[model samples]
Target: MPVAEPPAQPPTTRTTPISPSTPASPVRAAVVGTGGIVTGSHLPALRELHGRVRLVAAVDTDPARLTAFRDLAGDDVHGYGDLDEMLAAERPDLVLLGTPPALHAVQATAALRAGAWVLCEKPLCLSLAEYDAIAAAEGTEEGGTGGPYASVVFQHRYGSGAVHARELLRSGELGRPLVAHCQTTWYRDRAYYSVPWRGRWATEGGGPTMGHGIHQMDLLLHLLGDWTEVRAMAGRLVHDVESEDVSTALVQFADGTMATVVNSVLSPDEVSRIRIDCADATVELTHLYGHSNDDWAYTPAVHARDDERRTAHWRTPAADVPSSHAAQLDGFLDAMEKGVRPPGSGTEARRTLEFLAALYKSAFTGRPVGAGEIGPDDPYYHAMHGNHPDWAPKEQ
Candidate 1:
């Protein structure tokens, strides 16, 4: 591939920053949903930024979970069963949503309308229509500026390895990326789908393509810039579920790069990987859930292998920062403090979501899907599944 160097920063819609007169006190934050994600990721990340973020409240429909959250978050943190009640009481500066996929749009919109910035988990919402509604709630509909914005948690795009790779690719140090592959294959037993919302189209969206592989796809789009089209196939396979258990897509990027992507919940030996073959070198990352600098490797092409200066540049090491909620949160807080939309907010987030929607549309329609093809009039705009395939179970 012989592509030009793109802009250094990711594409984003310009929005007015918060007023400089705002108080310098720690940002008051509340956690929505006391699920495993909250206890395992968001809570610890919040605690890591103690001086900058004060955990003020938590919400969960289940009383026991709420109580557990209160116990772990300390007495100062109040617990509530209702999100709206907690929002009204705490009036937090930030809201971290760890709820199920179906509730994300409603909860995030509520938080945004309440003048709170939101950090939501991946697969931000079920459809582009819901995404636009959340964007409108961010005050962009009136004047693209001011209070409240929503960002998705795409931790894989953080960390030293990904950052370095992005810089190298952007600067043409890795020479234009020609071919690539992204794999997100993990095993999930039948018990996993017993969680009610786990495999449903109305709730969890579109199987591994929407939920599991989205992280890697987002990272791929982050490094490659923009994708132009996608051709895909999906199936339920071993699992008796409303959505497919496995999916594969052939993606085309604007820079003439062609990439193969695979998302699965049936692989015996699980692994998440991304490999980019460029004119000068091949860069790869291999890890399960998260990765550190050690998980990355770079190899120069045969013709360029003898170039000492180029090889040395690729070998230089950076601080070993693992991809985690804390890493992404730190950057989000920086953007918040500066009064700008974070990396994974606004258009940047929608880009990833739209791609997934297109993948599903392609699979179900038995045709290729293009970027900017799905609009308000398109059925897929309202739901990931659109007109359900014959194989899809009917809604109850």
Candidate 2:
């Protein structure tokens, strides 16, 4: 709270600037996969970043997708069928990984070793062992300062509303966060799993808990800090997938706070929500995929003097900005240029993964799981389902 602010920085925010380059050359940027997220999000965000980033190369196994990427990226961009070939031919300053869960670690580690900052999508890796491998390649300060490293994509935490709330909690304005609720319940038809990697633990990690609700739960961890323990149950429910269609957990925080977390893909009427009950007020954010100022609400406690005053305190920036891959990509690029690890860097990303591992362990073993309970020695750490053959049906 006492940190000094940088000049010309955004209101109430801190940023580090880097040494000036020739000013003509932009940061070299490339993409590793031509999946939906990459086409729909990453490419658009990179376009938004314009002259600050130069489009370099793109990699994809599918010739049709690679041709599409080249068309969008331009004729100057090199297209490659292999990741190693692309990295070797063009040593980009930044590499965006939109590959599947199983390939993220290997791709990211290769990029980091190639001396480029890395940005990978959600569910970073399948296991902590893989996470550690990425971490080793990413050994550096946050925001790419000491050197380049891999960071996960969890952009909701970067929105103005979420950021403002974080400041309020940090300054004790909202009082200590107590009981809370987080829900990530959305519907995914059986056809969605037709893509081989969608439901299997080996390819996509766990189901809704690991893949879908992780964004909301990660925001939960960002706001409330460390969780001490978790009791949870995950079930296949109605989905024909190999992983749970729904999961629920009762979580305990280090500060004695508690929260009920629900992750699901079976809810007909879908929404992503989080309500934090602070001693002084209750702050809530409700939105489907991404959020803007309109998605946030604040309700003060009965003892509060005036609702107007609380609104004044909780007012986000006048500008409306939705949380998205573009916003996080901007932040990651800024951090990379400044020689910092960037938002969603390995450590910050690891915290969320650790919590997930704990949840999966608790659900699989039918017992309460502690924060560090599932490590290299734990079976659940390697295989999310552990040895519970009865827990899920064979992947169809």
Candidate 3:
């Protein structure tokens, strides 16, 4: 048997599957790594979804942070100094990961093997090897059949505008994808990396490409479908951090369309944006971090008809929700009850990770990297630095 010319991504779009509800009550949820993201996003979301979810436990190495969170969460939410203790005692239905990049794979897999659904933040482990392990541990059943599952927090996809855009493209309203652009350029000062983990291959992973721009690029893949190849370049251009402060890549999609990807933390003014040109119109979404309905726009092709009708069609979608972890968390919980893997779970979510790996592999090797090129045996597969053994950040 021969491999297809360019591998095709599974058309695993979000679908509602009727599932047998388990345990009858709101999902027993636990959160690990009680850092800024959890306190800022997921905890609040859980609070809002109070009727459908419950917070049972919290875990972190820092007792003081845990105490602060406990006070905010009230007396009922228990804080554990050790993750295993929390897992063994609570056996939560779901575990949300807000830990650093280095700890994601081990912690996420532990939760999954113990039979809890895992929701982790971006970068999703340091390399392809870790990603494969997490992917395998997610199990076969949608809701895991009493086992475990995992999902990365590509929260932007759950917004009302994003959901609406997906609807338009799937319905053929936007037409076939042709050209696109994705940019995640923001600023991070030297003080940001003063923490031990912010800028290293073994810890922080790749800089802007892995840590920052991943969300927008994932959104690009969300809209454009799978990419076939990437011709890219990266550098530790500005910041003295161990990873690239800036990087750029040109991506080729399996759909025969292409895109320009830019991820950087050097820009004085920051913006995250994605623009897709389809047969009928050009669709765009822009914001610094997350976006609401107000941040999206559509312009119909001049040669095409339905300008006024298109305006009405675009307005048809309800723009009630903004892009945030809360939105994706709601979807994750809903999917768990339906006994199906949530959006951004298993193989479905890792397309972005694979693309992420290819981008870095291309930059490090000074050539184009294809979808099937980087594998388990490749050096880049094991570590983000790959064979660039002597590479170092300036005056760190």
Candidate 4:
């Protein structure tokens, strides 16, 4: 696919922040795709912030699904069979995309060009090139601090536990992070792959690495900062699928932290987990799908256990906010209200996407892949598979 030309630069003037004394109008919002994610996650999130955002439109190719969504969204919401039509008619200020992974780049580019902000689902695009193109569409060259930016829905980063942990790590309160482990082990039987897009490279991107484990991996990166290199291995052990059902990687962070990452869909006993061992404390979060304050624990090192003040600081609780679509949406809405680029957008999101590409490259090539190595000229920059390895399952 040809890259989209960057849209005309808009005014760089910042909008005044929304204040309680001078209330601002609700943001006009539209949602694309009426799949399970739309109904189960995005819709409920929008409803939670009804006073701040109005669901002006919804789009879906499936007529039955569209009608069902419209019924649930009420008569005030407009429904469209096509995304372009909905964008032209509603001209929403925000576009929430719950579409398939293959469609994110095109849809997000379209919404950005239409002068709307976008909050898209995971595996934001197919490759690094696609991510760069979307960044360009967000007016990055003209300074990306203003309107019409795109943010990905890495909801795990917005939870209170994550927020607090990040602060401690950033402030050196937890000391230097030494060793870490991130896991996204969830079971998916053959029946789950029956969905045409579930296991295909062209459609679903990669296997559990891109689709399932990305959430926890993203959170790991969020707390650990940039990664320098990845040495990985992957295999299609159980299910008959084009992509690997299990992948394991040893990642090196720029901060001198070495970590292990595992993404799998073959584990019968399922869980999502991340553990970071710092000089002074060990921080661990274990949960499935989402996490909360209760799921996080902080343990002081043996030497520091005697220091009551230090231990208390590490254990202090922040407000209990679980990792959820709603929490992330609130952050996005805050950014929109302030007329600034939101978290999980542009380069920040690209980091996670790039890390995934590196993992795949390392797995397929049987070598370490480094940061900033895959550029426009690299095959992996255009597609995750790059030079397809013989070990990868042949597409049937």
The best candidate by TM-score is: 4
Clashes of each: 0, 11, 3, 0
Q: Model 2, clash count? A: 11
Question: Candidate 2, residue 44: CA error in Å?
Answer: 0.7
lDDT of 2: 0.82
Q: Give the TM-score of candidate 2.
A: 0.91
Better of 1 and 2 by TM-score: 1
Ranked by TM-score from best down, the candidates are 4, 1, 2, 3
**How does each model score on TM-score?**
0.92, 0.91, 0.91, 0.92
**Can you tell me which runs of candidate 1 are displaced by over 4 Å?**
1-24, 140-145, 389-396
lDDT of all the models against the reference? Answer: 0.86, 0.82, 0.81, 0.86
Query: Which pairs of residues collide in candidate 3?
Result: 142-340, 142-341, 143-339
For residues 1-396, write the lDDT of model 1, one tens digit per residue: 111122233223224454432245777889998889999999999888877788888888888778877878888888777777777767777899999999999999888877788999987899999999999888543343454789999999998889989999999998989999999999999899999999888889878999999999999999999999999988878888888889999999999999999999999999999999999999999999999988999999999999988788886365888999999998888877766677799888999999999999998898999999999999999988886734544334
Higher-lDDT candidate among 2 and 3?
A: 2
For candidate 3, write residues 91-198 as lDDT tens digits: 677889999999999999888776788889887798889988987776565344433568899988878999888888768887888889999989999899898998
Model 4 lDDT tens row, 1-396: 111122334322122323321126788889999889999999999999888888988888888888888888877788788777777767678899998899999999998887788999998898998998898887432332476788999999987888999999999998899999999999999899999887888888889999999999999999999999999999888888888899999999999999999999989999999999999999999999888899989999999999997778776376798889999998888887666778998778999999999999998899999999999898889888885834575334
Of the pair 1 and 3, which is ahead by lDDT? Answer: 1
